[model samples]
Target: MDTRCNDITTRNKNEALCNACLIPIKENMRFYKCTYECNFVLHEWCTRLTTELKDYKIERDQLRHFSHRHPLTLVYLQQPNHNADDEDEEEKEKEKEEDFVEEDHHGGQCEMCNKEIWSFHLCYYYCKSCNYSLHKFCAELPMTQQNHPSHPSHILTLSNLVQSRNNFYFRSTDGTWKCSLCNLMWKNIYNYHCSICNFNMDIICATMSEQKINHPSHPHRLERMSGPIVSGCLACGNKHEGEFFQCTNCPTFRINLDCALLPTKLLIQNHTNGTYTHSHPLTLAYSYPHSEIISKYYPFCRVCDGKFYSHLWIYKCDKCRYYVHVDCATSKREPFMSIFLHESLGKTFKNYKEDEHPNLLHCPFPDEDDNLLKHHMSNQMEFISKQHDGEMLNHPSHQHPLIFFNEQTSVDKKMVSLHDPMKRIQLLCDGCVKPITTVPFYMCCQYVDEQCCFVLHEWCAKLPSQVQDYAGHPEHPLSLLPKIPGKFFGVFKCSICELQSNGFVYGCITCEFYVDINCAFIPKEITHDAHPDHLLLRVKPSTNLSKRYCKACQYSVRYSELVFHCPSCDFYIHVQCALLLPKLIKHKCDKHPLSLRYEPVENHISQYFCEICEDEFDPWEWFYHCTTCAQSMHAACGPLILQCEQATYAYDQQSVYRFLNVKFGGTLEIKGHSHRLAFVQGLERDGKCSECDTKLQYEMIFKCLECEFALDYKCASSFVS
Candidate 1:
């Protein structure tokens, strides 16, 4: 058919490239356009000349299949061009054979037969949009087969299992269909179904195709067998009588037919209105991990928080080392599937506007304006601004005038009102309550002889005096407070994170809401690797008393506190847990840095327990693990704080031991006790505080060196000089 165009637009010229040779079609060249509305064309003569070629495409170049969402286009693997100057024909033939059926790593596989597409050059119906392909023969199978051996009573219509089951509620044990012939769970691929009869036959069974299949989960080819093997199935860990596949190389490595056809990756979602979507695609693991250090063969399931038997197959994330039992991963309450529609999924990027705190209508601290203070990386006196004489009068946090110091020094004759200014002592910043190891810090210049008054980090000294409509507590504006007002002892529990701190706080007196300086600056939205698929929006506490738990550690934040919530997937993590859980940590128990594992992996040798605390913890909760040393421990036991060598903690009787650290192990004698008390720590250090009447193990405390007497940090500091 001769079709001539009088005028060609730029768009048509782009599509004018002949699909056969990839060369743009000129005005004089005869070409045939694709029948379908796609970017494909063929040189008229090239189509006729290729009929007898080795890699001849079917007359119909594009197919709209019921199995896939997009139209499948025809593609060919280019053959090596032969010429007069080329080498021997035998060598050329060998090269052609070798290249004939090479594997395409990213090409994926045929949805019809559940087999890898050996070569893109092989004639197949391919969908460029969805990365789906179908073998030419498999695609050409009769769409409706009547008089089939399995269920001959009615006509069977070809259907995509995933598409057909879109409305079906998924169950962990029954989310997919069981093949009528082989009795294996089937999903993701095509199936021949008689809807009225409620009968389904897998494509492999319908076509009676049983060949050596290359399963993505294993390295060796799997041979199809007719009977069940003695060993349990690797995927589900259950022994069932049915058709199965056994690895050709590893005789012991056998899996049921359903497991053999399981999709390579799955996306699981909580269907129970609970927020627990696993961030990464879970891959089917054929064998227990050989890569990580294994203390035991059974791992705890992330979903059910139950122990895994050694034989059960699992779907896991290699990056996070997250593991779950096959059933638990695809359970009805939290059903999972092999594929997802990406566009319908929520955005991963932050949707909330940037925090407007920087552009506040009123400055937090009127006296500590950016223009008023001078900052330097090091102790450079020359760099100090003329306006800043290293001193501030009547600061809100303290009664005494404060002077900034960049380094440790002996008593200075610059009119010091301090008691023993020459004495060396570790200083803690009253703002953050962290030890002030590095200077350019402010200390009370007008000190009372009884106690040192107040100290601050240079940055802490300039905290905003007030913030309005903050995300953490949006109901009311918060005024900065150096310490809790109307309380003799300034220690107060933070309203947001629920951690006790004597640090500077942003509080609203009317609401009785308070957050430490660190919590005050919590961003409205955060992007963490823990849930990389979506931004974690800061959610205000709910008035309802129902407990909401974190996905990572499975711990509950106080109902009155804020949480980092995934807007797209309903996943929730505690704000403090999200910020404090390190991806990797160094511990003395193992030489290697222990990586944070969201879920425990297989270790058949022993039961799960923390190496550091020597206690059992919820395996579903996040933990730090050293695969090299086979050491694992709770995230809390990994020593998130700085080492003791960085700064010595010296608490005086007059000041609160807010961020103070007592020398870990030491003996002290009291007036009434004959034996000295030694510092000890652990969950086992249980007893009421001698003076405070609180639990001793709740905080670092001292126990009697030879008796049962114990004193908490509050009481212990009272005895310090």
Candidate 2:
């Protein structure tokens, strides 16, 4: 056997193989050749490694690895002494096994292959600064190589730099490199790269010394096959011509190079499901178990809400059951998003709980202080079961005292018993005019015809008397009112949404600026799915109406309306469009949910048409599509097109207020009107408004159900607002 040479760092400039590490020794690489006629070559760095020798005494206990910023410390456990008694030796062996289990629990994943450093051999390199770890064999990898097999023309240097990319290199959203050889994205690890040629090979791909690989996605070892194979990849469920790997045991189970090298674990941040954002680590699932499949519906991707093919792989949280598409796991806009949101939002919402009801911030009787309130209530109104009947309140909204009920038992015994027991009646909240389905609510004690006259949700009942720091109207505090305070018609135009509402309003008495209940909870800044790169600012309608069209529906956003605008990107979305147009939804036409697409599908030259209406539509605008079925539809044609339907209130039999899906000639029943109003587009021949006396040309109006009491949408705000 030849002894390894030391103190020999000169470049060999020879095309040969490193006999120690088995990597190619290309031109300009440092290597040693045998002085004898026998051809034997070794890399200069190979001199420091103990070649295939177990239990060899290491000269250095620590090594500085390029993958990590800190020095890596070697953890080694020695064999127990055999001189002990048999019983003692058995006990020591058991203790050693327990220690190994403990080490496995505390161990970190190796940065190179994303596998746990099991310490089975009781030897591994670990960084104390960060939990980055590496196997002993992985530590001997060459830092740089000239004329690598992946890119033989130029030298490949080991780097973790994501920004060093040439024009040919398309950088992924998550700041990871798409390895040139494997075509899989990787991050936070060293990769051999040539910036000049835009070539990159991840550490795992660079170290492949065998044609066979044991992939976590399969139980069998897979052998690489050179091809333009027509078979589909089981990981992504996409069929394309590509070099693939086939299972040695099962030929049918094949994975393309891209899917075979996918990262086993992925950590995503600022990923959104509707308006909710989450940052959780997702584990790559080989496949969804058969038990999890429901009614032939596979797991839905939380980001897009579309059901991906069941056979395809996905990244999911076992606990949350939160599934994400394999391709949608990363975001190229995340780095730009943080900086934009910080500068745009200006204030952090960390203090405010995103899931909490807005009215909970000003709850007069909080759950935490229930006992204390009960103590003080000793001299006050009588109390019932804490779980069911609650303390009574002399609410200002009703003349009679209101009794609180938290559970179905109390509602049944106290209120339901008064009505027909066999009949099922839906209770509508008097505050927001919405159905009171669940929870703590207050019902009027004084009954009219054996029925409670009033009802309010516990949160709705505790609405703050005044919003002192409302983001919409900073000039003055908005006072909560049953209706728009000064309007004789009991309706007011919501300054935020530019819609009319007669329900609850938070209004500025001085400025006459009012926001409906739904609009009142709108955050000052929001991170919408449409514009993930920046936070959308809540901007008061600009006076300039020429460019006030919404990017979503392409409808005109009137100057009097408020919109969520991205000043940096010139993106403006209607408040209703932003809140109501969900990222994913199930339509009647398709069994699977459709995902919203921001732009036209690339390279699709065919004319775009709605799957529902079967009418041609603009492809450049936002639309919903199902990738599995290749179906597309317009937003207006979808079922959730009633985006502006905020609430429904029934004042009486003849007078009801609700958002109607009114078109050019539709009809609706309003709060103040006794009969339904007919929707009509105002014509040049249209007469003046009954109230405002303004000409009704170039506008939408609701004509009186009985007579020519024509009212424009602006004047209609009085009755509906």
Candidate 3:
């Protein structure tokens, strides 16, 4: 695929040559040229990994020494080519044996060192399938902490267990964020770190035995520690689960793995000003401005309102005290990893028309022409909605800039704002007239005048201009655009969110890493009421990631949304699950009060059910319960409350409201049958809902009193909505 139709094999920069794997040929990596007129070219490794050479891939990756009693197992430098015709038993067995998977190290923790290995090159023996890991370069760390630059007064010592497992409260950020050196976040990397000075390091840095480190945390020498640690780390309150470094002077003081390994200096770019602000880059500082400092104190991270702690690595200006978090600095909205484009939108280069692109709208950025952008946007009152009401109002679909709707009718039937309406309408999103599933949508006459009656997902309005690393595609960045411009309005699907959209998309102009607005900037960690005790992390499995469901909602958001997972408990929650929800709520039904409760996962006593919705809910899911009525309802059924006795919240009343799905009731009119429907708890084994003709198992169904008419909650709810 070179620009020149030549059989040249020399390392060249201008030519994009390699064709076997379709990557542009670059210098240094050797490639072979074709002797024939077809002018085909391929990288040397690609040539060996081709489909025809599939059987030889394992042999190439693995090497047996001359005196080898056992074969040295090795993984591929990249994904090895697969054989499509490998239906034979031998190939199947080989596939099962290899399981060749490359793990994404976004938030994995090394069990041995208790430090995250963000880069694979940093660790030699970390396994993704299990928590087992050992840095090949550094086996057991060396002892004797003395003469370090960061600490110089006294010698550091080794200890075991930063804190006992029994006292694992007030957890440290040991495995949560990355090292002070790498600036990457890791959930678990294990090591004693620096015995004194409260310093932490990952396994890779521990291998550098020659350097005795000093840190500002203490006035002493800190060294690499060996053996199991048992005390709690002073820097972070959490008890050490793996290893720790202790201060020889202050025997009680300890530091975990993440702090000891921070780098002394970094030549990082100053993104805020786009310059190298100082002669020296940011320096690692252990003693930083504490929050208690007076006005003229140390610099704090603007991204996260936090001060620089010794155990935590914070970037600061070498010339000044300016500081920031590593993540907030490196994570600029630049696309680097993009994979979907290559596989999905292949003909984009052929079909793309720059001038006719839909994203290139008549509108410019708000910053460029604020007045014009506002004027261009239609300004009209909602059907009954008003912005910034005093009732702490929120739309069912949109969260921000919320309003209250007052739908009323005058004698002429023109329109008027009513303070309270007895019955609520089914809330619908203007984007599509579907009942709003996610909460806090836009309503009122303001949106009505805009032609979009009520409801708009907040993400649909406030989309980020760009996004960085998605689950895969770590090569190029993607851009958010308003779909492909012009006549070709082909249906498009977001790889992350898995929702089909013919609208705006976040796409890499260079590649096809595309996702919908809802999938952008998903939080990596979440503190949830669903799982009250521990923080849930976002884990994107490399394979079969499409099928994992959230434990709370008992659903998955395809590839778009991230899942908050608790590795210890093996619990999973959707990104939506992270949203702050109330504990108590009021519903229109038997109205004493209801408190939110998580249905126990394993309950053999009796299956709990939500009375209002009549939908079988996951016992592990959150629902509202009224002790008085001895009944439960869904938070989705109404706005939740902070406490049972607190003020009533009426699902943040809206003009277009979602109706509660009441399945089995006394008497319901049958459209096709001349009979009143009656609630039925049991019937023959083959009993089904007459409306949708689906089996009603272990749940109540609305059946005609005198005929075969019936309805299940799922179908019946749609009619009511």
The digit string of per-residue lDDT tens for model 2 on 1-721 reads: 2232223335565556554444668877776765533244566655444333333333578776534556778876343444555557678756644433201232567776565554233577887778778877567666456666767786665545542443222335675767787677777556777656667787656765444666767888887674346677777775646668888689889887666645555554433321333344567788866656552234346544446665778877533445676655643222433454322211123333545433221211121112111222233332232323246877776688787765564543454422211133334566654445455567777643455457666666666677777777778888888765456334566676555555577888788788766567665666665555355777876586665567565666676567787666556777766654546655556777777776555334355667754666665456778878878876544432222121111111111112311123336677766778776655545678877999765356777757777888877766765
Error of 3 at 36 (Å): 99
**Segments in model 1 whose C-alpha atoms lie over 4 Å from true places:** 1-389, 392-394, 407-427, 445-454, 472-475, 486-488, 541-548, 556-560, 580-612, 616-633, 638-688, 691-695, 700-721
Q: What Cα-based lDDT does every candidate model obtain?
A: 0.56, 0.57, 0.42
**What shift in Å separates residue 258 of candidate 1 from its native position after superposition?**
7.0
Question: Which regions of candidate 3 fall more than 4 Å away from where they truly are?
Answer: 1-422, 427-462, 471-516, 543-550, 553-561, 576-587, 590-595, 600-607, 613-618, 634-721
Candidate 1 accuracy as lDDT: 0.56
Decoy 3 TM-score against native: 0.28
lDDT, model 1, position 658 = 24
**Backbone clashes under 3 angstroms, per model:** 10, 7, 76
Candidate 3's residue-wise lDDT over 388-462, tens digit each?
Answer: 356334543333443432232421354432211112323433332223433344454344354433444333333
Best model number under TM-score: 1
Deviation of model 1 at 241, angstroms: 22
What is the number of residue pairs that collide in model 1? 10
Clashing pairs in model 1, backbone N/Cα/C closer than 3 A? 77-121, 296-603, 296-604, 296-605, 297-603, 297-604, 297-605, 298-603, 364-465, 365-465
**Which RMSD does model 2 reach against the true structure?**
19.3
